[model samples]
Target: MSESTPSFVSLLWGTLFLRPYVFIFLAAYLCLATRHLGLGPTLLYLLLGYGIAWTSEFCSIHTGIPYGLYMYIPATHSQELWVLGVPLMDSLSYVFLSYASYSLALFLLAPLPRSPVSGHPVNTGRYNLATLLLAVVLFVTLDIIIDPLALRGYRWFLGQIYGYPEAGIYFGIPLSNFVGWFVVGLVMVAVLQRLSHWSVPFPWLSWGQSRSTNDGYLGAGLYLGILLFNLILTFYIGETLLGLVGLFIYLPFTTLAILVRCHPGFKAN
Candidate 1:
């Protein structure tokens, strides 16, 4: 078959696969995740909670490194191309972590309540700006860890845009590989923030909520899983444990730092 051949069935499947249904599913999940925590705004967190993760997945596809593993998995007469070892699900973590960070930041800052763009009638002056910003930051941070790992052979690069056929390293990271991640991450975040303006019901969800145990735990779990999964892959499949350990250390510290900054008056010391 020619590459130009377009199958109606395939198109249909793809459309269904990329439909808005998952966003709805994500919103539902957010409610559950934040129900116990007393966080600021559950609904606002939903958009970044899902959109950022989606953005990360999209980033990995184009860059072919960072947040994904190059495993030769068994496919239908082919190998499964995954970004990290965890498949597409890893992208979803971008959303959860971004949301977690946004919520944590808000909780600590005690910012005014904003409303979702959808005009969901937020009680305070809520805005989705924080969520959007944090989403971008988290994605970039993931890449920072990934670029060096790929150069060190902890993660495999599917395509050689630069470097010495995967044997060379610049500052412990392949120049081409790092460039790819930075460019992709920057562009993706810009696009997603615009998309959120249109699709999100309330902008405040991005910046309107408080920190809660729920957000913290969910963020911790999502990141912890990513860290462990990468470590396991490092031992059995590759050598990306450095990135995993970095994440294990960085994520908790970030959450703690935000907490400390927000509630400076309270001191156990």
Candidate 2:
């Protein structure tokens, strides 16, 4: 085999072994998305999401358009995978993150059935402009907690994978980064909405048969899982102030989500 072949294999396996958390979340996303959106749509979202995310990162490093200029450190290139200097896992993360955000938005915006016989109150994953925009907002909100702590990755197990040439205001992250996330979320959800209309039938790939009443909550739970993971890490690394800020930012939204679940008015048909 060629020398580059081994390196590529190593990077692919290393990315999964080194960053097990990303795959764990990805697994959750696959299950949740396939159940609600069908395997065909989920796979399409995964492929398209990765493409958009990788292209965005590739462009940002070179041209500083959407996310401004930020460079991957490539410190772990030999140990993990680096696709053109961007960590493979980094762009791959956008797939699950955007899906989780979109799932949660659907849970909140769609009308819930009052009957207990049906699955969880989250109606069929529907999309409107309001839902799409809310998903974008949620996608950006996740980064509000994630990016700051990630900047301090050197202090934790994440290692120092990337950095910005210039310092930023919010926990050393730039406003442009969030703006880029917003744009990505918007684009992703909009595309997903369009894809939902396509007739790409994959009946054999369907995994929704084992559906549970609790399935509706899984997507939102995945969102919370990621949010709490970052928040706990923020505190673990002794960033008490930053952790508190994240909590404060999420408190009202969490409250609203809870109300959406429990409120009788929201259970309207």
Candidate 3:
């Protein structure tokens, strides 16, 4: 074996041990963003996430998958604060995720429900406060659906604190994790929306060159693609049918929720 092979294996082993949840988060991000962002951006995000995940291997913070399957071993403090356990790549994942979700919302779910909560009919425009709030809410809801399953095993990095196996159960999820997912997620989205100049009109995919592309096809494709790919990847990597079942159960309800939320006056008797 080459000199680097052992270290690489060790790093992978440590990541699995220390930050197991990274895999689930990474996988989920890949699946969602791939379907939504497609080609160039999708590949870019994947490489970015991989690099971040790789760097996190040296940090003081630990993350793992499957509760205990993998772990992140921290390098000595002399390596510099960011390099120790925080891996540059892992930090980068947040940027990618925040941008991906924000763009996806604008493209697929934004101009949201003419007032998602109070149901006040309003005009659709660019980046209004209300629009931003709705975007955050949508991202949080997606995180909520994901955390219960994600935190059960893979969740949180070492020293960071949130959703550990020992303490078990924080607001119906491992305690540390629920807070992390919600708080971090909210903050990330806020930063990306407020500070960044990276906005683009969607139907990021080329075929989406018309009104139907934005209005229906791209969104439909995202949902379907997520549903299919998640099922397959979850089964293959995790080797369990439960992931497939969860995806099947979620797609319909999620679709219904999206439809109801989008169509303001469509209340059923």
Minimum summed lDDT over a 10-residue window in model 2 is located at 207-216
TM-score of 1: 0.41
Off by over 4 Å in 1: 1-134, 146-164, 168-172, 191-221, 231-252, 255-269
Candidate 2 accuracy as lDDT: 0.83
Report the C-alpha lDDT of model 2 over 31-138, residue by residue, as the tens digit: 887776778888888999999999999999999879989988877877888778788899889999988887788767767564466645545546578888988899
lDDT tens digits, residue span 48-162, model 3: 5445334433331344321222233334122222334444334544544454455545543334345566564333432455445544554444444443443332332233222
RMSD of each: 9.8, 3.1, 9.9
Q: Which predicted model would earn the best TM-score?
A: 2
Q: In candidate 1, how many Å is residue 47 off?
A: 13
Clashing pairs in 2: none
- Model 3 bad stretches (over 4 Å): 1-82, 107-126, 137-167, 170-173, 195-231, 237-253, 256-269
Any runs in candidate 2 off by more than 4 Å, and if so which?
1-6, 113-125, 205-217, 266-269
Please rank every candidate by TM-score, starting with the best.
2, 3, 1
Question: What's model 2's TM-score?
Answer: 0.90
What shift in Å separates residue 33 of candidate 3 from its native position after superposition?
Answer: 11
Candidate lDDT values, in order:
0.42, 0.83, 0.44
Error of 2 at 123 (Å): 3.1
Clashing residue pair totals per candidate (backbone < 3 A)? 34, 0, 37
